[model samples]
Target: EPVEVVVERALAAQAVGIDGVIASGQEAGPIRAATGAGFSIVCPGIRPGGPVGDDQKRTVGVAQAFADGADAIVVGRPIRLASDPQAAARAIQAEIAQALAAR
Candidate 1:
């Protein structure tokens, strides 16, 4: 869900009995919080540094977004734009592992 569509679609999904809602970038945590407990929020446009020439304006690092209560963070360009894509992904994974371990 984009910021413009979150409230309506989130409520719609909830009305339809969907298990969860995936809100992109900025809206994930707030949408999840707004939707109340037990609803999952999958956030896209997640990067360890920042946006990487991608269309996603709203972005945050893995640890920060995870700390903010996103159920999951989606990464695309961060790994795709890396010189060593696998290593970049592994690094991100390691960060996630650390974050999760701390929680």
Candidate 2:
């Protein structure tokens, strides 16, 4: 969906008392602004500098997601399909740590 549509839906969801919304990283900032700091924005379609393939279209790196005001990020294919799942998870963790530290 377009980022504007996602933001609109998020705002509507918040208005109706929903605690959280799932949206692309691009919409997190606007949604957060409209809904305030307490509203949870969980971003999916995260792709950490790799092949995007076909499933997801609006993907962002971990750091960018956080910068965009995502309260949490959901990653799937990168960790699940990696040859070494543990290492992939660790790498993502490191990135998240670095991003948090930078903030």
Candidate that would win on TM-score: 2
Clashes of 2: 0
Error of 1 at 65 (Å): 2.2
Write one digit per residue (lDDT tens) for candidate 1, span 50-103: 555556677877776676667788888888999999999999999889867765
lDDT of each: 0.76, 0.83
Candidate 1: misplaced stretches above 4 Å? 1-5, 51-54
How many clashing residue pairs appear in each of the predictions shown?
0, 0
Candidate 1 versus truth, CA RMSD in Å, comes to: 2.6
lDDT, candidate 2, 12-51, per-residue tens: 8888999999888878788888888889999898877633
